[model samples]
Target: MGLQPIGRRVAAACAVVISGTAMTLLLPGAAAADHTDPPCGPAADACINLSENLSWLMSDGDVTFGPVPVSHGKPGYETPPGVFQMSFKNRDHHSSIYDAPMPYSVFFNGDIAFHEGSVDQQSHGCVRLPHDAARTYFYDLEPGDVVEVVP
Candidate 1:
């Protein structure tokens, strides 16, 4: 299939169990301003909340996955907040700058990407996600897809 804009895609809200409570996450459009809504608007395919360490996948203002755990850049090397389009993806990537492994990498902002790593630890600048989440992001998101990073 060719690239399709989020507004053209159809999807339904999903429910996920967090802690002990089952919560329903409804992805909202650009006009959404509810406190429960994700920081990123409907235009974004993926959204990251740095302070909460959470990420979500969305399609046409409908949640496709998450509110899942993630780890981002720590103190000095902070994950910048902005809306960006995905540039590329690498199933098995090697970081030349850090000389480390970055599996299922989905690059959105320069060298900073969403990659498989320990969610409990901080990264240099990338958004580190659990293995499953990273895999999902890598496969589900295409180049030119929008990604939002919020503080």
Candidate 2:
């Protein structure tokens, strides 16, 4: 079939509806269940090596992950790159970048943490991932473990 044209406004509305539906379908619900920690790392918490950075999360001696994209401080307030231990965690969190709710945040450093972030690079000093990825990171991170944030 020839290209079916949609007017600008109609196309935009359709986009919104489609996106909203997708979000609804993906939303975590009652059926969502917690995954037990794997017998060891290298599975869900397996650290993936990256050319730029290495991300990590530990649920206990038994959990951790790595090499995920994360945003750091804005122009002048850049996050210091180094090894730091996780200090805080919240399954339900409010983002500073956007008022929207972030389901998981594992603090690897004071004020600086890892959580779901806006679609674009937007954060003060937090490892931002897609919502699902952040949830996974949160579920896997444990307090007092090192999460290396690199430059």
Badly placed stretches (over 4 Å) of model 1 are: 1-37
Error of 2 at 138 (Å): 0.5
For each candidate, give its TM-score against the true structure.
0.77, 0.53
Global CA lDDT computed for model 2: 0.49
Across 91-115, the per-residue lDDT of candidate 1 in tens digits comes to: 9999999999999999999999999
Residue 71 CA displacement from its true place in model 1, Å: 0.5
What's the lDDT for residue 98 in model 1? 98
**What are the per-model C-alpha RMSD values against the true structure?**
7.6, 13.6
Clashes of 1: 0
Give the Å error, residue 55, model 1.
0.2
